[model samples]
Target: MAKQERAVRTRRLILEAAGAVFDEFGYESTTIAQILARAGVTKGALYFHFASKEELARGVLDQALTLEGILPQESRLQEWVDVGMVLAHRLPAEPLLSASVRLSADRKARDLFGTSWPAWIDFIAGQLAEAKAQGEVLPHVDPGATATLFVGAWTGVEILATAHDESGALEKRIALLYDTFLPGIAVPGALRNLDTSPDRGARVWKLHQAQHHARQEEAAAATA
Candidate 1:
């Protein structure tokens, strides 16, 4: 059990190191040597987990759909809003999510290793579809189409946000995204009820961390 836990930690270290390198330098420019140096792990250990740089890139891309910081909401559209806002809130600090964006836009690496954009789109589409079923969205709103465009807009907005300001501009941009888009899709009642506050992400993250820590403590107590 101890050995397995150690391996998990090592694998995580490698992924984080590789993500930071890839985020800073495009996939084509990154080298195994840099990741090794950053991770402080042996070549054998690195290879054991990720055989190649492409695999490491894939590992990072796979993290694009994490729901870690989102708490369930009464409104599905609100839940979807939380998804984007939470990501924006965490983007400045989370290399895995940011690195995935960097890699996905790199033509060479994108052709070599596919992205998780479709997965994110699908997830959002499902949320919108559920909201529509619950009468929260307009009858004319096409969930799948809106999801595709929404995700695309998010990508473009994030690129602009990072380029313009490093100081909390991301959340505002994300909030703006919903401010502009949600009105067309959501019903009047729902739109009025929805909270697209930029600070929504930070608030959700705090609650999520509190719940997560409580869960850990409960598990530890049970095991003890």
Candidate 2:
């Protein structure tokens, strides 16, 4: 059990180190040696987890559409909002996600490896569709189209924010984006109830962690 846990931790460390390198140098410019240096792990250890740099890049891309820091909400729209807010909060702090975004935007990298954009669009559209079924969306809103637009807009904001590298810029821009789009897409009452706060991500993440710990405790109790 300890060996398995150690292997898992080692793999995660390598991925995170590779992600930081990719975030800084991009996929094409990044090298396995650099990743090894950053990770402080042996080449054999890295190869055990991931065969190559391309595989590591794919791993990063795979994480692009995560729900790691989200909690369920009564409002489907609010659930969707929490997803975005949590992502916004995490993007700056998490190198793997930032690297994924960087790789997705690079034309060369896209030709070599696929991106997470389509999946993200589909996931958001799915959420919006559920919200629509619940009568949370405006009459004329098309869930898929709106999802595509949101994904594009968010990516654009991320690019600009990355260039600026200003603190809280991404979160603030994303919050305003929801504020601008929600009125047109959401039912009036739902829109009024929804939160687009820049700090929403932080709050949701805390709740998510608490819920996860509670679940872990319950599972341990059950086993005991």
Best by lDDT: 1
- Report the error of model 1 at residue 106, Å: 1.6
Worst 10 residues of 1 by lDDT: 61-70
Model 2, runs deviating above 4 Å = none
Q: Write the per-residue lDDT of candidate 1 for residues 1-224, one digit (tens) a residue.
A: 69999999898889989989998888989999999999999999999999999899989888766878879889999999999999999988888888888888788878998877888899999999999999999999899999999999998899888888768899998999999998799989999988899899999999999999999999999999
Model 1 residue 138 lDDT score: 98
lDDT of each: 0.90, 0.89
Clashes of 2: 0
Give the CA lDDT, 0 to 100, for residue 154 in model 1. Answer: 95
lDDT of 2 at 131: 98
Q: Report model 2's TM-score to 2 decimal places.
A: 0.95
Clashes of each: 0, 0
